[model samples]
Target: MKKSIIYSLIIFLFVLLAGCEKDEPMGYKGRPGVYFNGNEFSYSFAENPWKDIDTVLLPILLTGDLEDYDRKVKAIVVSDSTTATGDMYELLEGTIKAGEETGYVPVVVNSVEELEKSVVRVRVQIVENEYFKELDLVYPACNFTFTAQIIKPYNWSQLEYFFGPYSTGWWKFIMEKLGRTSLPYWDMWSPIPNPDESKYNMSYYEMSNIQQMIRLELADYNKHSTTGPMKHDDGEYAGKEIVVPAPW
Candidate 1:
């Protein structure tokens, strides 16, 4: 009878151990939630409204405890008919630090021209991760949508219709002279000019060309400013025989 009781006790212990192991959390187990701080983010160039933007950093937050080791979270910019791969914007996949809840993903604007054509929409989401998961019951899932607008500095029709043939040098001359005071506007166009030159992706020439275009357009506006007795108008006043106060 004692032997029978001992055998039963051993069987019970084995079942209990098996149950515990089955219920135990795995090495990567845990509800790690990911989300963006805001639903939408927008930006425009201040200096030259037509100029392309450099980069936009989207803030991401993770909730719950992270794994003991750092893990890479997969992020993807959903492409649609309007926003396709290698189009106006590019996808940004970033990592979440170990034991940290804050991270940032960079959504790079590919073309200033495309932004000017229309409002570009970039849809990004925190996709499935072996280490993390989307928060349940969240509206729209763990996704963020951003709209970027590129405002044209000058009316294209007016620039071409009113102004005669203009060269790039003429454009550069005005930008250097006028763009200096419009620093606040220009600062928005790029975080830093030519941020990475080692990648052989220097944009000095492209940026210079864009700046010149804006300057030329502005100069045309100044040249065509209509003067009336009602109010005094500001002119380019840069080597003009009739100098007037600029209406900044």
Candidate 2:
């Protein structure tokens, strides 16, 4: 009889442990959280002729499991620190779509003559809500700047191989020759392809004539010389001859 009781107790304890294990399911049990991709970004409209509206897409990251339904991720514009008037920019609420861990906050800028005259600043903060719990991140509240200045492109480092060296004068010349304001690029390591870059990126094969044209233009400038053969007037290549490598 004592052995029977001991066996029954052992069964009861096993069932209780099994129930406890079932209570703690397999997937994430943490609270949903989100944060900005980075702290700052800057852009210029110096060569952009977007006289109506343009968008600057900023990325956001999520923690915890993705939901089956779309979730709202809000960015509040900090007007006190922003220099762009309400009329100059609109902050679009970001979204982490169903089953997605990433999203974008679309900051819309109204291209007016004002943006071409001076630098415009906009700041934003990511706020937590019921959908997303308060994360320790000092997220979003990111810095954005728009200006008339023709700052060097961010991808200039990788493009250094193609364009030789950087100089503002040469940069402008290259852009004019390329007949485009922005040179979009794709990272070899990106997990998914960026649609814009896939569609618009200039192929190396297409650059043969363009490179020849640049040399021709520089030669023409020297041929009609007021100043000697064109040397880069600014940047690291300043005082050095302006040259874009002939296509291979």
Candidate 3:
């Protein structure tokens, strides 16, 4: 009889707790949101001079409960970052259409003649609205660097340490000396185990030798140069002398 009574009390407590839980209100309130998904970007007209403008589509994330209606992701170029507006670039509205989750913000960058001498930059950011909210993120901003100079050559990364900064005139000079349409390049897998690429591939030592040749040529050219030190004819390094460092 005592055990039965104890079991009845336990059942009653469970029922009472269930009733309380049913009557209580929620303590936390929440809403659906969207987030910034932009990344660092840099472009150069050196690769494609004929193209006057380029559009970079930055991605954004939609969050919370999925709805069956179109939504807009608002973008802002927060003034804290080097914000470029007007002719430099144009930011378009991002959209997540009905029944769809992915969206993008389009930025149209206009080419400027001045870009041949310097780079223009703009930092884009997003804001929260009735449809979406910002996610907590460190380094929430993505930086962009736009220029007309040639992007660093893929093969010249290691050699660049000795070669100072890249210069359009300097690179052209190397090609002229080598009498090749394209300079040799190599990665871990190439020209070693693979013998087919031997004609086009170059070793670090070979690349170093090429650097020495350019240095010696530049030194000789400068010694006899009556027009003064040979400076770059065009590009971001224009008016700057082409200085190739000695072999390490």
Candidate 4:
């Protein structure tokens, strides 16, 4: 009877240990929880957002296709009396998503007269790949961070402070008008894959050409708009701050 009882206890202990192991299950994978500003937010990561089997070198393939794919990275913003911190999105899992690269910077406006505090956070889960053995493979989590600031309408001096001195063309004009009478809208942007660079021969000249074109377009528009009366009259303008939506 004593031997039988001991055997039963040993079996029960094994079962209990097995159940605990299953609960946490090592490795990254499955539905991930995300939070923003102390609020529960919705999000999704790569379908195969894991590199457990091998280091991914090809175009980072999301779990779902591009169009059918919907992923939300959580972000936040905070402000105090003297300064305001822009948004900071966190990259806590894997490499940044393919085609979309985001950078987060603290916005400085006019000698720090007007500033705010902000932060953005994100989370992702990765699963083991069955194709390779653990000895020869490495898994990496992919994630990203983003930041933004509210450019106030009354601070004209902040215009130069935000973009820097080299931006003297249309950027300056836009910033000035935006600061005086309009809410300045900032689009956290990044260059996408250029077809020529991807398929054909890539050259620095080609990249420079594209950037110049964008600058010229913006400069021309600013010149035209400011040329009109009632537009630059007050060295100020009335406009709304339009924040660009993040492409997840």
RMSD (CA, Å), each prediction: 16.4, 7.4, 12.3, 20.1
lDDT of 1 by residue, 1-248 (tens): 99999999999999999999998875325677666655555444433344454566665667677666776767665555234346566666766677766666676665545544455556676677786675442422233323333222222212222222333333333446555412222222332222123322423344455455654556565678685111212223333332222212
Clash pairs, model 1 backbone: 46-185, 47-185, 47-186
Model 3, clash count? 0
Q: Lowest summed lDDT over 10 consecutive residues: which window, candidate 1? A: 154-163
Tell me the whole-model lDDT of each prediction, alpha carbons only.
Answer: 0.49, 0.73, 0.64, 0.29
Indicate the TM-score of model 2. Answer: 0.67
lDDT of each residue in 1-248, candidate 4, tens digit only = 99999999999999999998888644423422222111122111111122112121111222312222234332223222112233222222223233333211111112121212342333222333331112112212223221223222211222223332222133335434333222222222312222112222424344344334534544555567654422222223333221211212
Please provide the root mean square deviation of candidate 2 (C-alpha atoms, Å). 7.4
- Ranked by lDDT, the better of candidates 2 and 4 is 2
What residue pairs clash in candidate 3, if any at all?
A: none
Q: By TM-score, who's the top model here?
A: 2
Model 2 Cα displacement at 212 (Å)?
A: 8.6
Candidate 2, residues 1-248, lDDT tens digits: the string is 99999999999999999999998865445777787776776666755665467777766788888789999887788878889888888899888889988877788888777876788788878887778875676564688777766877645554565678888888887788777876665444444323234333765545455567777877887799887777887886789987767555
Rank list by TM-score: 2, 3, 1, 4
Candidate 4 vs. true structure, TM-score: 0.21
The order of the candidates by lDDT, greatest first, is 2, 3, 1, 4
Model 3 off-target regions past 4 Å?
1-30, 83-85, 138-140, 152-248
